[model samples]
Target: MCSGPEADFARSCVSSITSSGQRATLLTADGVRIEAARTPRTPPPAGPAGAPADDLVIVLAHGFTGALERPALRRAAAAFAQRAAVITFSFRGHGCSGGRSTVGDREVEDLAAAVRWARSLGHRRVATVGFSMGGSVVLRHAALYGQGEREGRTGAHADIVVSISAPARWYYRGTASMRRLHWVVTRPTGRLVSRLGLRTRIHDRDWDPVPLSPTDAVPLIAPTPLLVVHGDRDPYFPLDHPRMLMAAADPATTELWIEPGFGHAENAAGPELLGRIGEWVAARG
Candidate 1:
């Protein structure tokens, strides 16, 4: 399966399963410590025959400054668990995870670590659903790991990818919210506020070599199914971002949803919309 160093650690990592679910400490390829939790699907109501279980697992990636314990993220995880097992983790620089956030860059290794853990749990299929910053990470992860399996990149591949409220490019200052976010990540004083107020640790260093952008990554995800969901009322990124991502992807394998009244990522997603997303992943993943 996953042959990288991270996957090696994932395979060897000890996990404890309880009535609640499985919990463990994961090590990324770069030795970053990550906190992760797993929740099995909620059993359906009684019927003539019990609902057949599927081997699908969903790995959720949270937006910038978001964590597994956040109420919004917890709610989203619960909704997805209705259809399949769910894995939610705090990326490095957030929560108890060790490391600094390089924003969307290098976070792909954190996601790979989680996916390898899912495989270790014996799940036959993996679906990744990411929100905002996490959305961009999923697109890039799919491009790098979804394909090239035969070339020795295997286990970390996602069968289906769902990106919600992701941006097409980097360093976007078009929106007031984004401009403020840039300040938070770039200024020392703003970073202090982010640490004390938002509890997120951002890396101060800039990218030496820029990673692939979401639009560029989408083109390489051919044959892998992708779902891009965006909100017209989103404050961080505009409709143009989602439109560009869809345009870069293969039409035969891509699906786009532009919600009229929806706002942003997990925080803005209502129960009804989350249910629909769960259904979509269940049907295809």
Candidate 2:
């Protein structure tokens, strides 16, 4: 790693005002135009032979009802961009993107498209960091790639995966919030919202036409390096969620990092944890 006042600082959404960065619009397979910001490195850093660029691209996905530039995600993007290429995006029906939240089912397509875009850039290793619903989306992508659901990529090419406060298994009972979410989704009113195509929500209070869950598919991503971070005291998914997810992963390559007293998203994530995350991904290469 190199040093400078510049390198000391990461390129976040706020810092983007002074750098070369822009949003990339990709119309997903479903025809909804999901929006993502690409934080580029004017000068990519050097690494070991065949190593990821100094500015490895990290695609960030937000939790329920979050925008591409949510304050927490922005801070994280800035922090990680200090060491890699970081991109953050809003899922459909959330932020400025079209359509409503699909509760991780339909959002998988959006994530898949984003992964494709990252690959198109010729980056040998792309890492995905997702929070909440975004984590669900990332996990789903791993499954799709794991099983060759689409084009058979199984994202076997991706060098790393980072998930924070994600529900490793859906429809689990430990959190009151999770129960509420299930209630909302199973309710008639929630189904109506899904039918109407509403976006800009964290929790989809509606019915999803294709509600394939993460728990049901997480096992498919075996052999791929996995990092599952969670807050032990989180009232949302609880510590057990990540534990369950790791159970399905290869123990040699899987890591479960528990943050004390953290919540369900990126806001509470500390610099130490962020740096640890960077070190983890970097070490994998």
| Each prediction's TM-score versus the true structure | 0.92, 0.78
Model 2, 37-84: lDDT tens digits are 777643435655544465367888787766775778877877777667
**Residue range 1-285, candidate 1, lDDT tens digits:** 112233243344355778979988898989898889999899876666533257899999999999877999999999998889999998877876767889999899999999999999999899999999999999999998876577786798899999999999999999999999999999999888987798787889999899999999999997888999999999999999999999989999999999999999999999999999988888886
Candidate 1, clashing residue pairs? Answer: none
RMSD of candidate 2 to the true fold? 8.5
RMSD of each: 5.2, 8.5
- Report the poorest 10 consecutive residues by lDDT, candidate 2: 1-10
CA shift of 110, model 2, Å = 1.1
Summed over model 1, clashes come to 0
As a TM-score, model 2 comes out at 0.78
Model 1 poorest ten-residue lDDT run: 1-10
- Alpha-carbon runs more than 4 Å astray in model 2: 1-18, 41-55, 149-157, 179-212
